[model samples]
Target chain A: MTKTTGVGRPRASGAAASKREARLAVLDAAGELFTGAGYAATTTRAIAERAGLRQASLYYHFPSKEDILAALLEDTVRPSLDVAGGLSAKLAPVGARLWALAYADIHLLGSARHNLGALYLLPEISSPRLARFRAERAELKRVYGSLVAAAGVPGELLGIRTDLVFGLVESIAIVRRDQPDLDVEAHAVEGADSVLRLAGLGEPDAGLRDSARALLED
Target chain B: MTKTTGVGRPRASGAAASKREARLAVLDAAGELFTGAGYAATTTRAIAERAGLRQASLYYHFPSKEDILAALLEDTVRPSLDVAGGLSAKLAPVGARLWALAYADIHLLGSARHNLGALYLLPEISSPRLARFRAERAELKRVYGSLVAAAGVPGELLGIRTDLVFGLVESIAIVRRDQPDLDVEAHAVEGADSVLRLAGLGEPDAGLRDSARALLED
Candidate 1:
């Protein structure tokens, strides 16, 4: 009797785990569909079909297509901001912080390249939604701006001229993605170093080395 | 009788000149459409219609859509290459040349943002046609590489990391196009100067301003 009861409990636990996995599968399918096809062109039914789930089941997981996108953005953006903030707290000297920040950024972009494509295209399809996303992005930029300003460099003189450092990093990643023959990791590290140096960040150091290692490890 | 004959000839010449103007108008319309909608999305008939010409008339001027794009690329690419080549010729010392090259690149991008977008997007749609375009771009990169190699700066140490400099400049310009509020020119110049200094291109002579101006103006 005890053995029979234990077998039933294990089966019940497995069923619960599968349900969780299915939910994650739905989100992943939605992200890929939205990025590959323009957001406006993608539909909830399509995402559900791609996930091999009923449309009603997809709705059970996500209230709407926008909700799925918002989840993907949160998954990508929140960790990026958190990692950046944590790195900034630990690294001393403005240069080290900047380098670490760049590494974190590149890592985020590399992991979320597909989702980012959707994010970039979103602006063309839905301005109000893009505006909300940009607001979050702007907050991240403010953190970077403070670090640049604190480096005892005049913003104008440093020629760290725009508030688009993050955007530039992402754009380069897109180019690198399109060119598979190129050594993308090398490009990302070198590109990040160049931009940091441009912002009046002094010479490269072990902190940068560590940051690059950490970011590239995955 | 002589005065009457002169009037008739002048009118004939005027009509011929008007026909030439109409041909140019068609080309311009086709270019704008191709740049906006891409080569694949644009149709010869649509281009002809936009130009206020019969579809058959477009063939009289150009063979196909590819021809129109080729014409646009040829017209724009040559002047840009010339500007880059001209800068390398004028600036003495590798560091100054590097700075001038960066500024010239930014200026070129600003003027040809639409063309650059088309250039970037073409690869995704047509690999065979893009091959020739990529070859031209690779030659440009080779020119930059030669300039860096000629600087006699050891690769192991100071100076713009030659492999990454061009990528950095390209990324910045791409980002600036998406964010119009940014001061791309100033940032590009400063970024170049910093890279040069870091790469050990010692600062230029203050008194050389007159010589620099003369070379540029000439």
Candidate 2:
């Protein structure tokens, strides 16, 4: 596999690489540009140039810049949705499950090559192109709500707890924004613990934490 | 006092309101444009136009768009800092002080005329123009730190807890970005409670709540 450069290649063959590789390259470049220069500032031409693809070839992969942005946003949330789905299948205590879900979500946010989560709230992201990503994130939030509710919060407190629990995990973006040398592994542990705390579950039992860890490991 | 329109005026007299009001109008327009159209997309001329000022007049108030943005950013955090400072002078339980600080900060974020807090993490905000706002926010975070410390977070958990506590309060931006009809009062209550929970001080005492309320009311 030849290494892909982030920019400056003009060869048609470079962009003409297998379609799958080209698509991933476009997403990677869009993620960086959107998170760094911001969504509105990053034009498709810039994204194509950054991806080392001619404008036409980049178009072949993504019809519009919003399409590219929507795809990138999906990358940020889909993995956690997948993890939540996987965890729901297996039997586990609600606190442990919540901990496991948060751990996996924070790990993904912290470990992504780019700070894609920063783009999650960009004003431009509400376009129709992002409908699927919105649905997925809302689904992810619902998963958080169920787990938080199971922790036995009063009905009135449930909405805020669920929002805060999700917010605590996504705060990794805020952490990563300023702390360049973030220790993702340590942050994942502490962040998940914090989520559990906001859910009204104080310290996770050692056994419950292990169970959460085991679920995540699998 | 004359009500100002958000757009569509070329009157010199309107833009020539007292320097203080003109400055405020510029900041208000910048806040709306920056949070709605996004920082990179919003031009200084657009802000001036929105504020009913000629470009030259807007420049007289804020030398650049970034300066306008920096001023708006300051508005989001400064009131909370003032509240925190006031609470510090009054005798109150640490947990109550923390709750009041959180409540006041969350209220400012939610009740602001514009969602200025949404611009807190904009990529454009890192410019030198925002240095003062950054310093002030850092100071506010330190106030939160001392209060969280007084709540007895151990040395090891101090950093993450403080970050999460701050993040929880700021998460109102995220909430407001989605829910236009947000009940800011109810959210301030719930958000402050969540902050206490994150500080390891669950369920602030009713007496403590009253003390915090008294501090804010004053």
Candidate 3:
């Protein structure tokens, strides 16, 4: 946006940058409207208007309202999936790996950057629009289950413990939303530790948590 | 139903029984549809059809689809509120009382009688119709927070810990819906124990659990 010239490569790059910015703008606006208004009640025009774009322009980037929703959900879970996929590479113990994942997930969901996690709570969850997100969540759970099993949680407790990890992380969003003055890092640390304890691991060691936080920073 | 005589008292009692049966039938059918198909997608005709009644007959029992949903939510949480009200009189230790309350709540939420608790996940939770249920749920949280404080959960953890209690109990409905062949009582016990552990309370004692159960039974 600074001192742009009509040079061939520069104009193309500038246009591409603006295009990306518009796409992200639409996504952010849609996320807010979708989470604030029920998806059923949110319309393409509303999303477009909220994004300060024409409906046609919105459609040019995202084909449909459902597509927008799918994008929002994908954005929410993509980071968790990435973390889950790479957890083993960190070479830390199962508890640390889990703490890393839960910490990142809690921070994302609890942050004001667009509460895509709230979409998961929608009663219309039965709607097929969420099938892709559901599959992703199942994969996320599988990762948690593996980490939980490695942490010495009994076989029988796997399902409940997995549920507990999910509950602890997701509850951060709800808690932060209600108590907006919450300390995010403290809450995230507590959530990650609760997940560790839920898996039958002892309360996470502060040193281990520090290392886990460093890994997430990476 | 077994060809009762049309005498005065017999006819009156039989009519009352039949009417009550019809009401329950509608509620069960509506619950299945509302939780399975979702409230917005479900229609009165469908509920009536599922209940094996004429649409008019269904209307006679419940005035609207929203009314039916309200009934389901009220039916699910009313029992918990009632038990929570009486918990103080049970005279159990803090841990035992907490365990008993959580056990009963999990059982209710997990029961196949109606996973209407799932309905609370609906995107339409903000609908004016759910205001009454929301108020009731807030009261339930108040009761839970009081018990949680008494159970020795530190003041600092109360907000997140209370949220954890709710998430653990409510997750049962989600877990049961996913793992349909789940052992209900076993799952409930584990959920209750997990809640106590989340609060830093140790595993509840078997004798204490029994005494608390007896109190609930009373």
lDDT of 2 by residue, B35-132 (tens): 78888888998988888888998988788878888888888889988998798789877888899999889889899988877887788767898999
Q: Model 3 over residues A1-218: C-alpha lDDT tens digits?
A: 12223455545577787677678878888877776666666788888887778888898899877778787887777888997777767777777898999888887777757666656655555558768877887888888888888988888777777876776677665555446577777777777877877777776787989888877766
A73-176 per-residue lDDT for model 2 (tens digits): 88889999999989999998888899999999999999998888888778876788889999999999999998988998889878877877887788788878
> Ten consecutive residues with minimal summed lDDT in candidate 1 chain A?
A1-10
True contacts kept of 1: 0.12
Clash-forming residue pairs, model 3: A123-B121, A123-B122, A123-B123
By lDDT, is 1 or 3 better?
A: 3
Which lDDT tens digits does candidate 1 get at residues B63-102?
7676666655555445546756777666376555666665
CAPRI verdict (incorrect, acceptable, medium, high) for model 3: acceptable
What do the candidate models score in CA lDDT, each in turn?
0.58, 0.83, 0.75
| TM-score for each candidate, following the candidate numbering | 0.70, 0.92, 0.84
Which regions of candidate 3 are displaced past 4 Å? A1-12, A121-131, A173-183, B1-19, B44-49, B52-64
TM-score of candidate 1 relative to the true fold: 0.70
Give lDDT: candidate 1, residue A143. Answer: 73
What are the root-mean-square deviations of the candidates from the true structure over C-alphas? 7.9, 4.7, 4.7
**Can you tell me the DockQ of model 1?**
0.17
